[model samples]
Each structure stands twice: as C-alpha cells, then as structure tokens.
Target: MSQPPKTQHASIPEPLAHPETRGIELIQATQRHGRARDLFPVWAAPNVSVLNFTVGASLILLGLELWQAFVVIIIGSLPWILTGIVATSGPAAGTSGSVITRAIYGIRGNRVVVAFFGWFISAVFLALNWLASSFMGAELLGQFGFTDPVLAPVLVTIVVAAVTVLVAVFGHGLILRSYPAVASVLLAIFLLVTAFVLPHAQWGYVAPEPLEGAPLWSAMTIGFAILASTPLSYTNSPDLARYLPESTKPSRIIAATALGGALPCIFFTAAGALMATGIDAVAMDLGIESALLALLPAWLGPIFVVGVIINTIALNGMTTYTASMAFQSIGVPIRRIPSAVVVGAIGTALTIYLVMSTSLLDAVNLMLQLLVLISGPTMAVFATDVILRRNRYSGAELFDEDPGSPFWYNGGWHVPGLLAVVLGAASASLFLTNPAWTGPIAAAMGLVDLSVPVSLLVTAGIYIALTRLAAKRRPGVLPAVENAAA
Candidate 1:
C-alpha cells in the first residue's frame, strides 16, 4: 500500500482522530485502550434485532418442529463461539482483517480474496441491514400515521443510510461509545416481545399440514449453514478489537464475545419459533415486522419496530467502517471517510435493488449459504498461517510495497495460499444448498449440506501440505521474521 501524504487535523477529537489511513499500518498504543468486554455489546446488539427472529422463523419453515427448531437454534449458535477467538487476532496484528490476509496470501493475491469474498461479504451484509432497517423505519412511521406507500419507505431508506454513513464516517471512537447503549435498549425491547408472544403460542400445533418437502436432514443442514455464514456477516469484530489493549487475555475476550453473541440469539430465535406456531401463516410471508405486529401487544409492537431501526443503524455503521477498511486494502487511493461514503452509497443502491426485486429473500439466502464457500476456506488458511508462523510477522514489512518484503512473495502471490483457497472453495461449492442454487455434492448426498466443515478441513490441510512441499523443494524460500514473544 502506498503511503498517503500526511495531512494534519487539529479540530478532531482524540479518540476519533484516527488519522492514519494506510490499510496495513499498526494501530498505535495510544489507541489500544479499549477493554475486551466492549466487544460483547458490539456483537450482541445486532443479533438482538429482528434478524434472529427471522432466522428462527426460517428454521421452522424449513420443516423443524418447534422443539426441534429450538434445539437447532441453540446448536447453530455454537459457531459464534469462535468470534472472540478471531477477535484476538486483531490486537496481535493491529490491522483490519483484510490487511492481515497479506500475511497468509501475498499482498496482491489477497486482493482477489478481498474483492470477491471479504468486501463482497461486507457489502451483502450492509445491503441486508439497510433493507431491514428501512423496512422497520417505514413501518414505525406508518404507525405514527405518516403512511405514504411510495414516499415513506424511500424516506426511511434515505434516513437509515444517512445515519449509517455519518456514524461510520466518525469511525472507531463513536462505535465503541455507542455499543453499550444500543445493546441495553435492544435487549429490553426484545424481552418485551418475548413476554407478549409466549402466552399466545400454540405449543402442540406442530403443523400436520404440508408446506414444503424440506426433510429433517435438509432443515438441520440449512440451520447449521446459517450459523456458519454469520462470522462473515459481521466481520467488523476484529476491526473493533484491533483497538483493544494487547494485554487482554484471549480467554476473557472469547468468553465475553461468546456469551454476548449467543444468549440473545438463542433466546430470541426460540421466541420467534414460538411466535411462528401461534400465527397460522408462514413466517416469511408475514415478514418479521408484520409478525411482530401481529403477535406482540399493540403497545409493544411500535416499540419493537423502532428497535429494529436502531439495531440496523448500529449494524450498518460497523459494517460501513469495516468495509471501508477492506476497500482500502484493494489499493484504493481513498482514505477512511471517503471510502466509507463510497461503500455506503454502494450499499444503499444494492438495498434499493433488493427491495425492488421480487427475489430479495431468495438472493439473500443464496448469498448466506455461499458465505461458507468463501469464509470457511479463508478462515482455515488464516488459522493455518498464524499457527505455522507462531504469530511471527513484521508489521512494518507487511506494509512495504517493495519486492524484498516477506509478504511480497513471487511477485505478490503466495502460490500455496492461493492453491489452498481454490481447493477449499471448490470443495465448499460441491456442498452448497440454497433456494437459488444447490451444489452437486449436496444433491448427490440426498440434499444434505456439509460445506462449512468440508471447506475448512480441505483448505487447512492443503495449505499445510503445499507449504511443506514448497519448503523442501527450495530451502529457505520463505522469509523468517523475529517472533514477538507476546
């Protein structure tokens, strides 16, 4: 990455003055003062929104009974346990997740991964949140007797996008400061939703009625696939954790993140499953906002709708911030603020297209399922790289654009890392199952999907074997940097 010409900003606040725009630069020690505990709110607040409810309802629609759905919801949440583990890499690397990829894949090679998987993942998430937020805000305004079918939704979409962009423009300090408040409010609103919906639930009304032929095996696979895709959904955790003190224990970070992400999702998804039973219509047909309105008491319904709007703000803000970082990693000349605006505009456009298109939900499901194909292999490659190197990386050299730097392998291509991603993604593609698309392997295996586990193992195993072989072929080909004992 080429260093930008430094420009001074005297008026900005200390915390928000994160003036360093270089994608690979280390976050200085002064900025590394956030606590490990803050990440709980950062992650938990977004899941506390209607997204979990929708996911819960989706599980039921996919053929799981209420009790079976609840069990799978809890089990599906297990993947989030890795959130804190991945967050720890931030402080150690002092860079955004995409920049850290240069350590695994060479700098140039990392761009292809970033463009198709990393940045595309962020944009897709932004679009999803943008649409949900806008939908909620439009509904809430309609409740206030401001219902205008054409103008209202458009206005709400604009407002939500504006708020997201402004928050993201300010960057790190605002994100850290806002999380606690967002989490508390969302938690309270969702609890009220649970209380009102549970008493109305028809516990024994397991649909003897036929909706679709989603088998038990297919339901479980889709459920697991949903959770597997979540890590990529909110890739900002590490970006936030990059500001945390290096001394924070990995265990504490992991615990806080796991609990914070898991509890709300489990609770709300269970509630949503119950809500699905009480309502006669399919959950998707009602949509989350309409379902909440139909199920919750009149007084709490508006409050829950408002909560969705707020939740989307928090989610999109972090998404924009993280995505801007990913964009810069693509060798863009833009700085943080400009990059944020550009990404926000793109997300907003996609959000509009999603709402206009009849295939929005199907497209979203397909993308989420495809996430396993992207993130699964990427995660495996990253884990293997860090473990083999024993966390030894020259942070400064990683930013160097010159030829001799360790990260600039074979004209900015790490052959083994590239090969690992290809092999892993190929295996993952073989197991994908979504409404829009199903993999050959998934079809052959009686519609069972095993993409996530299959991709991770293949990616890591191939990368390791290739690296070992390469090392033997040409002694001392890979550069060794002095390891940091920390």
Candidate 2:
C-alpha cells in the first residue's frame, strides 16, 4: 500500500495578502516566487558565520578537553571534521524514525526501534546536561559559605532550565540570531583567559612522547564525544537555511558549518592541553586553577570563573533547548509543554543527581561517548536522505498517520542503517585500545561504541549500499513524491 502524493498546501500558511513585505517574511515571499521550491520556511535562518560556531563550540569542547585528556579530544575530532562535511550539506527526509522505516524496514516493524532511537537519546542528553550545569553551579558557588549547598544546586538547575525554556518556547530564532555575535565575544574572553595562564603552562610537564596507547584513544574519544553537540546545533539548521536568501549558495553554509565545528575545536584542544600541563589542585585540577590567580589580578579570577560558568551554562543551555525541540518535534507539531519550564524543572532534577555521583570531568567524558555513538548514523541517515535523494518531500502527506507513507513510520527496523551504525560503532570500539571503553562496553557488552569515526563511516556505507540494492530489486519502493534519486 503506497502512500498518496502530498497536497499542494505549504506546511505553514503563505504570506498574508499585503503588498508590503517584512524582513524574513520578505525572504519567504521571494522563496514562494519560485526561488527554491524545497525551502521549509523555518523561523531561524540557516546561515551562520564561521566565527560563530567555531568560537562557541571551541570554548565548550576545549573546556571539556582540559578536564580529560587534552590529547584525546584533539585526535578524536580529526576524523570528525571530515564527518561534519558529510552532515551539514545534507538533509533528512523527515524527523527521525519516519524516514528510515520507509527506506529500509517495512513501516510497521521498525517503529519501536525508530521511536527508541529518537526519544531515548534526546531525553537522556537533555536530562544529563541539566544535571551537569546545576551540579557545577552548586559546587562552584559553595565556597561562598551558603547554607545547604545541596539545595542551592537545585535552584541553579531551575534557573538554567527556565532560561533555556524561554529561548526554546519562543522558537529557536534567538540561537541563530545570536550565535555569530555571541561567539565572537566568547572567543575573545577565552583567549584572554588562556593568555593569563601562559606563564603557568610548563610545557615540560607535557609528555615528550605523543602519549601512546589508551591515552591516545582517550584523547580522540574526548574529541569524538563532544560531537553530541553537533546534531543539536544542526537540528534547527533547516529553519536557519530556509531563510537564507534564495540566492545564497549552499556551499557557503557547508563551509561555515564545517569551520564552525572544526576551527574552535582545535583552538580549544590546544589551549586546554597547555593548561593541563600546568595544573595540580585536586578540586581546581582541570587546568583553570589557582595558577590563574597568579596569572591575572585576583579580582579577575572570580570574573573569569563567572564567565566560564556562564559560557558553560550557555553551551549546556543550547544542548538542552535543542534536545527539547527535537523531542517536541517527534511528539507534537504543536507541543503545549513550554521549553523554559521543561529546562528549569528537568535541569534542577538532573543537578541534584549529578552532584551525588559524577564530576564535571566525568560528565564531559560520558557526553562524548554517547554523542558519537548516536551522531555518526544520525548524520549518515540525514545526509543520504537529503543529498542522495535530492530535495523532494511531500509536506502534508508526510504528516499523514497512515502506515503506507514511508514518512508515516518506517518498517519494523531499518536493517541497513541499523547495521551500518552498529558496524561503524563496533569497529571504533573493537579497534580501540583505550581505558574509557571498558566502562561503556562492560555496561553494554554486546553494544558497539558508535561514537567513533570508524562507526560513522561503516554505518553510512552499509545503509547506502543496502538502499541501492533495494532499488535494484524493487524499483517502486521509493516514494513517488520525494523523487529521492541521487
């Protein structure tokens, strides 16, 4: 039972009947005038300056790297940079589970897997990040002699969630709008902070050897781990890209996104590695230590600490906010739940639990491990659907709940994509000689650590090959409306 063709209707209503056009509304008009039929008309425009993504992501990732192995994060992202290219240039046929089930598995069978893949991770990451922020806030602020540090941490979570919710509920336009400007400022402060620690960095403390074995793997893992943030950053991109003047080149968007992820990452890794060479305090251990006091005036330490906290919170906020949007996108086109409220409540809850067990350092490591495992295939699936299929989706028919629509629900399981991701993650995990995988692998013994770059490629290749084979056997399997013939 094939799905019906899409209606002529646009997802959102077209511009109201006024001769005059506003800024973005004007861009929508130009798109409607036959500029690009595929545009989805999201509120956030897709284009971002290279500086915006690089600085922001760099600050976040590097701060993380210094805590773990500075060396590992650098090595991990080496392959991730190439991987990012394969992602930003492409699009998914529909939100998660919807497109994969149709292409590989039959509509009904893969539904559970699709839903699990989509919601489980989105929910978990949102919960974890909220906790990480609140926990850090409680501990960092504890020095001020506040009574009940435990309860205070909960309030920090509330504040984080509230701010993020406000941003998300209003729509993600704020993120796209502020990324470039805010990124620049963040970068400048980051550099200033690093400069303060220049004298403290005893390069001699860094190993003369390139730090072999699992340590090497650990460093790479750190880089790969941070990839969790990439998809969240990009999930809202279609909204951003749709508004890009129809005349703007897609190549620019790809370049900017790639640069945005890569350059800052490298800078952060290098800088943090330098700091790692110098630090010693067990509590202040993650490189930004008392040395900072000697490096800068005493007053600046608190100011920088606050900045670091805010920067980290902002990055965490972005992740939490986007994760919520992704969850809502799957749940309801018009989710009644407010994003701010969700962020506040969830963030607070996560904060209390986080304080009980993990350190900021540990959470960063966990985030990378989980992110890469999911990210590799997520990007692969999206890229194959968009670039390989070309831009052809039935806006209204896709939303139809009918089982026949490839987009309605995927087959019971998308074996190709699943296998690909499995194979890819397995390869990275299997091939690695690192210490970290011991915990993840021991926990999910049969499961592959899909976060590795090796997993990403394996998954993508298998899925692509499988799709081609299916095409050869049954030419009619593809949706007539999508015309996804690359």
Candidate 3:
C-alpha cells in the first residue's frame, strides 16, 4: 500500500479498482512486499485443470503399471526446479520474466524468444483450456436436460472468454487475490475425486501386458517428456513472482513453488491413472471432462463439471496474465490490457473452431510437443545465464534501446545467446515426436524422444561457455547490477 523506494523508472499509475501501470518497468522495493509462502497457493491453483488429470491417464496408457506410472510422473516433475529458481529473480529484476531475459539475450534478442515461447506458446495454452472448458460446460448443461449441444458450447465459450479477459485486464494483484479461494475449492474437489477413485482402482503393480523393447522405452520417454516439458509452458513464472519483496529467499520461494505445483499435479495425474484402471484410457480422449464424467459418482457429477469449468477460468486468467507480460516484452507499442484482449480474442476464436471441427487433445498434444523443443532451449538459455552471471543485471540497461547500453550487444542482440537458442531448438527438432509430426532423428534413434533433456543440456552448456568467454574477452559484455547493495 505504501509508495515504493525511489527509482529512476517512471511512477506507476494508480488504478481505480486494481493495480496498474505494470509491464517492462522495474517494480520498486516498496511495492515488492509479500510472503514467499503465499506463492504456493497461487501457483498450485492453476495446475488443477483437466490437462493434468489427462497426463496421469496418459502414462498408464503408455503401458506402465499404476505405481510405475506414478513414479515416472514424479521423475517428470524435475522441470519445476528451474520453475522455482527463475521465480526468485522477480524481485531482483523488478520486471516480468520476458523482460528479465534481456539480461541474457539483449533487448532485441529477447523479443525473438518472447514471440515464440512467450506469445505463441501462451496463446496455445489459452486456446487449449478454452476448448476444454467449452465442451465441459456444454456437457454440464446437457446433464440438466438442456440438450442443445451446438448452442451450449458456443455460449459457454463467450462467457468464459469475457470473464478471463476481464480478470487478465485487472492484472497481477487481482489474479493473486483470486487464487487462494480458487485453490482451496480446487484442492477439496480433487481430494474428493481421489478419495472416491483410488479405492476402486483395479490396476496392478505391473501392466497386464508389459511393453517390450523400443515400444516400452519410447512410451516411457514420451511420458517423461510430457511431465518434464510441462514446466516449459510456464517459464514466465517470474512475471508473477516480481511482486514479492527482494528480501524473499530463493530457497523459500522454490520450496513453495515446487510443492504448490507438484502436489495437485501428482494427485490429479494419479486419479487419471486410476480412472484408466476402471474404464479404457482411450475413452478418456476428451481429457478431464470425460474422465470425470465417466468416473465421478452420479450425484457429484454436476459438482465435478462446475469444478472443471472454474478450473479452466482460473487457468486462463494466469495464461492471459503471463501472455500480456510477454506481449510487453516484444518491444511493441501496445499496452498490457490491449495485448491481452487481442490474444484472448484470437485464442477464443481458435478454440471455438477446434471444438467444433477437431480433437482438442490431439491439438494440445501437438502444441506441447512443439513446446518441448522451444521451451526447453528457452529455459536453458535463461537459467544458464542467471547461474553464470548472477547479480549482473542493470535495471535501467534492460530497457535501454541505445546500442551502447550494457544489455545491448552486436547491434542490440546478444549473438551468443541467440546462437545457443537456435542450436538448442535445432537439436530438439531432431528428436520431437507428436501426432502431427515425428522427428527423423527420434525415429532413427530407436524412437526415443530426448528433446527436452537434450535441448537443456546443449543450450546450457553453450550459453555458459560462450557467456564466460565473452565476458573474459570483452571485459564487460554483460551488464552488472548498478547498486552494490543490491
């Protein structure tokens, strides 16, 4: 509530109902005050979406036993390590995640990454959730004897999109405030779902017919890829964490984020696997809605539908919020609200068409596979840059458009960072496998998809080595923090 510490960046414009004047500017220290632990609920709330339950169901279908599938899921969750670590940079950088990447990739180079991983990828997520929710909304209506199938989903999408856009327009403060209530309700719903299902699960410790040779390995690889690659879609977590006080320790933040993100994911994923044990996993092709409708008690079915609908709205709020931040990072002459509106509109239209014409799960899976290629390298580049050059950000230099600014390298692009991303993406492309396309190298290499892991290693190694060499040779190619105390 109090005014923040003085900074050269322009004063933030006060909002009538919600916080405003955020996007690409340094959040002053006074504004940077919140408990690190609160992030757990906020981060955890969005993971309750239908996609997560599908992920659990997916692993079982991949030929893993119930316990084996769950274990593999735990293994896939390692990407949250970077997710939590990157969030700690929010206070120090006093900016959104995409803007902070300028410290590694330079101002112009950051735009490239933002366009692909930030805007495009975010739009993909927003659309997928929108499609799922619309169908679920229609199904819920049908249960009440409103049998106009065509009319139901179309009307539901309009309402959902409008609400999500309004919330996103309010931006960070409102989004954070809404999470606790949402998360509590979501947690209770999943707990009920889990409690009801686990007792009835007939799955054995091992699959009835175990997968053999390359089929088994490839299936396991895809399962891990799905789990690990999940975090790639959320690389902009620092955009939310930027509101936290600079004094918040990274360790505390990381622990909160990890638990918040992992717990809901594990519970729902396991529920999906359990659902598969009773009914055919293939019947769950429609994702969480199908799984829930098929699995939940008849009396509780309406509640499950409502929970999923609410979950979709909450997820879209975060997606649109982060996408707005990514839009600002693009160096465009657009404000945050307008950017969010435009993206939300396009995603809504796309979702409506896909819901009417195609399979949402198939589309989502393809997008996620592509995300593995893009997000893996993007995270690797950003994380590696932070580790190699900690405390080396110049808050002013991040917004510096001048070629001579510390963040500006080789005509406003960091060549080494760009090179690393390109190489990492190309490497990932070789091993990518999805419904629409499979990588030639992945098929050749025993059909094993090592895209995320390979991309992470290759990008991190190249970035760290090149950055160190550049720093040594140029004697200050990367910027350092202006404040010694900082």
* lDDT (Cα, tens digit) per residue for candidate 3, span 1-486: 122343323223234496455776777765665677888888888888777766776777778777778777788887887888777777667788888888777878888878866777777778778887787788888888886856788888889999888878887877667799999998888778777777767866557688878877787788888878777667787888887766677788888887888778877877777767776546666554666676678877778767877888888888887787777787778988888888789788877887777665565566677778888988888777666655344455577777787777777788788999899989888887776668898889777888888899999888877776676667645434212212
lDDT ranking, best first: 3, 1, 2
**What local distance difference test score does each model get?**
0.73, 0.45, 0.76
lDDT of 2 at 99: 31
Tell me the TM-score of each prediction against the true structure.
0.89, 0.70, 0.92
The TM-score leader among the candidates is: 3
Q: How well does candidate 3 match the true structure in TM-score terms?
A: 0.92
Best by lDDT: 3
Model 1: which ten-residue window has the lowest total lDDT?
A: 2-11
lDDT by residue (34-60, candidate 1, tens digit) is: 567878888787778677777776677
Deviating ranges (above 4 Å) for candidate 1: 1-24, 144-150, 209-214, 282-284, 359-364, 474-486
Ranked by TM-score from best down, the candidates are 3, 1, 2
